[model samples]
Target: MNKLSRLLLTASSIAPVCLTLIFIGWMKDSRSLMIYSAITAFISWGLCWSLMQFAEYKLERSHKIIDSLSPANKEVTNYFLSYLFPLLGTDSIAEKKEYAIFFYLSLLFYICFSENYNFNPLLSLHGYKFYEAEDDTGVGFVLISKEVITDIRNKTFKVVKLTDYTYLHTTDRE
Candidate 1:
């Protein structure tokens, strides 16, 4: 099944369990508004899980598309982004700030707020590895696992078109 379908299935299955837990105070032994709390928790968990899955699906798909595009298309993508984010534009600062905040929140939400079952590329690749996001260059810099990095360097996973940006894998502290 597709990623969205899998995510929806997982969420539908888990929502009930979470609702049940909230309804019965599974761990806290605290009294909840039972039906109301259960409903809220159900909605919250289900939507959150679905969104997590959606992001993972998008990221994976984006990587595949980026890896397959031609050099001309890469140039087009860069040109579009550059024009879209003109530095001297009146709202550029606001746009940049908004994107930064959104990115930071996504990082926090996916990394810290999510459970182990939630999908994350960073976690899947390597734990405790650092990564950098370069917007202007249209590349996500990552400190991937050694095995993955080796594969990348060996051309197993080709970056189809790297016009202006590419991740630099570094382990040196200094």
Candidate 2:
């Protein structure tokens, strides 16, 4: 399904779970239960927001690098976050403020109903050591100062550049 549908599904799926907790609290007039529910919601939504922020930060950092190199190659400016999270396409990237607002709203909804649901942490969802081939044409991939790409035989990730091979979407190399 699309991002909107997936988002809706996530919100809908979590709602009943959280509402049930709220309902239990109401039935028993238990402040503790209510507080617990609230905490759970906050944590769940907070983490989600943090993850988005982290992704944004990564994109922005990449953007700066792209911009710095824009003088020589103007096309790099077109390399957007959509390229990273294809679920959100070029259109969404254009209206970043709107997307951010909607994402916040969605997180609020998800949090309200996220209390009782069990979800894996972000780390659990994807392991590190993700590799994408350097495929930015001649430029290949630019290495981040602290980033290290392991050399596994002939195939290895180049830390500095986002190669098409390592671009994640193109090759599924990660």
Candidate 3:
């Protein structure tokens, strides 16, 4: 997903929880509602920010790895990769379409009914890890796992290494 979509998703998820917490605190005749709300908002914002940073890091890392792979390997890798916050279905229809919807609904359910509403949907989602190889350009290399290598070797996908710099300089240099 784009940065704006991720920010909106995070905000939509966090706002309700913060408001609920603040309301509960107020209902309980807390010593200071303003202070309570302020603290809650701060914590919520911090958590959302941290989550977004982590997601961005993962997405960037995954993209770099995917880009470094052979064309065939890249195709397979892209097929399986799912963004933490997907705006729309890119590849297959079987993939989850409404990540933000599920996240928000799950979050709302937890906030409204559960005692521990600190659940994070991002952490609950599954993710794959690709091996990293240090490179001079800082773009680095990606090493597919043994299983993936084996699959490629078995012609699950035609694996051919291309020497052309077709994807080179696609992104900003600095």
Top candidate (TM-score): 2
- How are the candidates ranked when ordered by TM-score, highest leading? 2, 3, 1
Report the Cα lDDT for residue 133, model 1. Answer: 31
Cα lDDT of model 2 by residue, 95-155, tens digit: 2434433543555455434321122223223322222223324433322222233433444
- Model 1 per-residue lDDT at 128: 22
In candidate 3, stretches whose alpha carbon ends up further than 4 angstroms from where it belongs are 1-12, 16-31, 58-60, 63-174
Candidate 2 wrongly placed segments (more than 4 Å): 1-16, 59-174
lDDT of each: 0.32, 0.33, 0.33
lDDT of 1 by residue, 1-174 (tens): 234333332343233333333433433343432444466445645564544344433423223212221111122343233223322332332323344234323433442323212222222333322222333245433222222221222133212121122222223222
The sequence of per-residue lDDT tens digits that candidate 3 reaches over residues 1-174 is 433323433343344344443443344544354354456456556665554444443433312223223312232232222222222322221132243335435554543332221222322231212333322355543332223322222222211121111111122123
RMSD for each model, in Å, please? 16.6, 16.0, 17.1
Residue pairs clashing in model 3 are none
